[model samples]
Target chain A: MYFTSFEQFINMNGHGFYVWLSYACFALLVVTNIWVAQQRHRRLRKQIKSRLGRSAKV
Target chain B: MSWFDNWHLPKWFYQMASPKWFYDFGARLQPWFAGLALILISWGLVWGLLYAPADYQQGNSFRIIYVHVPAAILGQSLFLFMAVAGAIGLIWKIKVAFMVARSATLVGASFTALALITGAVWGKPTWGTYWVWDARLTSTLILLFLYTGVMALNQAIPDRSVAGRATAILAIIGSINIPIIKYSVDWWNTLHQPSTFTLTSKPSMPPEMYIPLLLMVIGCYCFCAWLIMQRTRNEILDQERQSSWVARYLED
Candidate 1:
């Protein structure tokens, strides 16, 4: 709304590259952190489940 | 007798010390924290990037403050949180406290790195350089190193108890850098500007700019809480895999 057009908004008056790049990095950081945590949790759950299965078999 | 033993602590404090209780409580709260973080951060970033007025001097480049300040603030605060949690773990020998401390290291390190990178990028446009060895910058860099050092130390030690104690001591020692980081711009001449917010004074920026920043800061805290809870739950599972409660937890 501040910018009259979408293009102007994206351009950010010639500082667009810097602004967008910083945000990209931030997005990457957030996504990577969440993804890694979720993956670790999933892996641990699987490992525990399999271990439990083996013990029950014995 | 221990100092806390004489005092009557609240019920939630004792309940929080139990890993199982923490895991269940975290499970109940994690989704809410994550949802709130998502909503607030997106709203803040949008408002900051599009709606907030540009700085008179820095122009649109100043928008980086939204990310930079929040990341930097969270980075420092999380370290302090880690140190305090580590201290609690050391003083009380609480397993959950140690686990929470351990979970905080990676998140703290990531946010510190985020702050440094955003600061550098913002610097390129405003200060005409990507990096500087100024007091504030250097201290923040040290904070990042301190976090990594704790992580590496924990990984190097084989036994969990030993690793916990070792990292706890290291975190407490490294906490000295936090205040130094806080006062770096004041204590020494630095290219970095002074803090935008202080307890005794109002924020330097206008509400339009700072409001988004406030949202971002609170959102980041929520995100950190969600992430830390998720990781701590994982830690509890890993540590208590052999316990009967964990087995029952896995079943249900």
Candidate 2:
């Protein structure tokens, strides 16, 4: 709302590229971190289930 | 009952050390923190990027602070926290402490990397260069390496308990860098600017700018809390795979 128009907001007084790039990278970092954590959790659950199955036979 | 029984740290304190309790707590809290993080970060971004007034000197590029400052602060704080958790693990022999320390290292490193990258991006516009060997920047880089060292040590050791102890020691020793990173701007002349937010003084920026920055910082912290809890829960599961509780939990 500080900017009078949408074009000015996008350009950000010509600093838009740098500002937007940093935000984009930040988004990537957040997404990748969550994805990795979820993957680890799912993988661990599978591994534990498999181990439990094996142990049940003994 | 003896006074000692009542005086002992709350019953939950001991329960907190149990991997099962921690796993359940983390699982329950992760989504809540993640949700808070999402809402706060989005609010900060919208206000910071669009509504905040441009800096007189740096122009709009200063907006990067919403992400950069929070990431940098989180990175440094996470390292300090890892060291404290490591110390607790060492003193109390709490496996949960060790697991939390392990989970924090990589996430801390990622935040550090984000800080460095964003700092560089901001620098090119403000400082007219993308990189500098200034003390603050250099010290922060070293902080990243220390995080890597802790993670590498954890992976290289085959024995979990031994690895935990060694990593904890490494984290404690490497913590010496944290103070260096924090004081580098004050102790030595550097191209990197002095910290904007401090405990003793009002922020130089107006409320419009500072408020969004504060939101971003809190959001980053919540995100970090969620991420660490998730990873720590996974670590607990992996480490306790042989335990009867894990077996029963897995069965369901």
For residues B1-252, what per-residue lDDT tens digits would candidate 2 score against the true structure? 243344557778789899999989888888899999999999999999989998877889889989988988888899989999988788767899999999999999999999889888887887778886555466668888888889889999999989988999988888875676558645654335454322113348899989999999999999999999999998998888888898888787
Question: Which residue pairs in candidate 2 collide?
Answer: none
What interface RMSD does each of the candidate structures achieve?
A: 0.8, 0.9
TM-score of 1: 0.92
The TM-score of the first chain in every model comes to: 0.96, 0.83
Instruction: List clashing residue pairs in candidate 1.
Output: none
Best-fitting candidate, measured by DockQ? 2
Q: What is the TM-score of each predicted model, taking all chains together?
A: 0.92, 0.90
True contact recovery of candidate 1: 0.67
